[model samples]
Target: MILLVVGADRVDAGKTTFSTGLLERTGAVGYKPRAGNDFWFDHDDCRRALADGRLYGKDAARLSAAASRGRAPERLNPVHRLWQPSPDGGSGLLGRSDREFVVDRIGRDPEDALFVRNATAEVPDAVADALPLADAVSIETVAEFNDLTEREYVPAFDRLADEIEDTDVAVVESYSDIARPLSSLDPAQVAAVAAVEPGRVRIYSGDRYCRACEIASSSPRDGAIEKRVPDVLDYLDPLERVRLPPLDKEQRDDPARIARAYANAYDAFLDAAGRV
Candidate 1:
């Protein structure tokens, strides 16, 4: 499953951690269009791929795809930097185009990948665009711009969930840590997460973690298919091939660590896929 993880502009909301959890839980491919956390696809990967491969488009896509599997250029790290606006002090993420670039090499490469501007809803759209078109995509919806929202993140999340329902999903994040089943979280996210890790501990909502110790026994979407259901399933879940997302031990940022975690698990998924 080529899932897109969307992070709102909050640091500790656990979007990356939740993505890591999803990757770990399902053992999916863990593809990174552009590195946000520790899992980086720096310029070197692009350069190396560009140098070694005849097809720049295919190879560049492959390089981004491979970062999650532990083999990528060194420059991939520091894919993005933290930048906040002056005076207002609002959050702004360093993009691939940032002057003091970290993932500058990507820009040097010919691929169309963009250094994400911020980890907001905008990031997901960019991620969706960069991917080489996958069967399904999973998006992690969280608060944007640190709105100090209680359930206010729901609208953005709901829009996201509505947009991607027909695409793909493995384990989607929900703010229902207490298992309240609030409408803020789409039923599909609840269904997807609940179905995948039935009766296991899952991050329900950004607010708290929910121990999914109780299986619904029936499908969360039991009654009928909702409107425009994406008709896609995470092919990687049943896949035993495990991709072990490489971890950068020196780094402390949860996003980076989660990226590596996803990469490691993705490598595991590849291993599992080999048997097929």
Candidate 2:
């Protein structure tokens, strides 16, 4: 399966929309390897679950709805980070110094538990065994909070890497820009995108300010292809690229109309990918 890294030069550059379009058009699954942001749920039940700490992410929920086939939403986003404050005054999402919450979640899988146990001897068996049976775990650890450590990140990275390896046409969405000196897209993440075989990883840039373009331009291109995504207003034909009038604000805001735009963009992307 090809690995398509859907990313933008800046935040809210329509990465998710583009990915959603691809999933809708191609039947490809979505995997958010590393997500660090707020969870927003439009459904009242999801909001309540999040308030109660039972559910953690909004992006995962939507991705699950759009893709996941029959798998759980949590599987798509195994490790996540948010800005919730911990009890200790430290800013990690998960409260407490011992981080039993993180340990427990990762340790739920017997093999993953072993990996966690090996990462730090401080983890107790009860915590390891207490892995919630739920499909996903909401991790509140963030680097900004200074709550994340190498031990925790290692397991999360392992999970991320494992998923990418196992997935077919993994649409990896980048977090932030890597070219900006202080970008969210780490060098390691860029390396992961680069690791895909040449011509297998399709890097598409969105809009004029896209950071993904910088990444694509700066990163080594042994065989990987980089193409500009068609503007949302375009009526893209898989056989030919066509331009259409831009959508008015009302039409753009309509979910149904935006979905159609994504479909067109996906056609263009797939067409470009085919030629490569």
Candidate 3:
């Protein structure tokens, strides 16, 4: 069964916290299909990943640790984008204001590759040099990045999906507020969906959630245009809402503590997923 955890807020939606707790409770393997971090705001994490010759967010690391067998962060997160703030108060290559797309790490382990965007040159020299550029592919335009992702991302996601097929449960954490991270992930395979925020979680039945996604999505099922939380919420009401109390730093880091604290919420998620 696939239990999908998505965010309502664009940032810090507590999806990771909820997911780690779920993984600890269910012994499910965690998969964060896509993730990214800002070079300016998440400098320490970015530098730590660069030191290891790869890039992945702290969320992926946390999920990795919380999983049953503890997969590598790169494996748990197949696609990781590295972003930087544009210094001149302008949009960078991807056309987002005050932000630039530095690089994207796709695939995992021996098959992994990096797509370094032209914006890399504009970042700090230390970051630029530390990035694994030896085998990186340089992208010069938005069209190029699109074309590359169109060819790479889905295939890489599929490869990772194959590895987790044997597990009883796979917990997928979406990136940002994206309704679904990978277009290739079949909603039919999803047993339940959780839309998370700072202090609450809305649980949706998989079939109804899939219907909402289909109705709200303007693009075809295989298209690149990702639907957001509000888009789908317009079509369906959640099955239930579970309150999540704030956690201290120590509790947040301990999956068992988190599971115990949020047992009711986790139980609701499993019941919705038909696990109960």
RMSD (Cα, Å) for all candidates, in order, is: 15.1, 11.3, 2.6
How do the residues 56-173 of candidate 1 rate in per-residue lDDT, one tens digit apiece?
2222233333335563322222122212223333322322122221111122233432232222323223333443324222222223212322222334334433443444433332
Candidate of highest lDDT: 3
What shift in Å separates residue 32 of candidate 2 from its native position after superposition? Answer: 0.5
Clashing pairs in 3: none
Worst 10 residues of 1 by lDDT: 222-231
When 1 and 3 are scored with lDDT, the better candidate is 3
Question: 160-179 in candidate 3: lDDT tens per residue?
Answer: 77765555789999988888
Question: Tens digits of per-residue lDDT for model 2 on 143-199?
Answer: 322333345544665656665656555555544332221122232222212111111
TM-score, every prediction: 0.26, 0.49, 0.92
Candidate 2: regions farther than 4 A off: 3-5, 38-47, 84-149, 178-259
lDDT of all predictions? 0.30, 0.40, 0.81
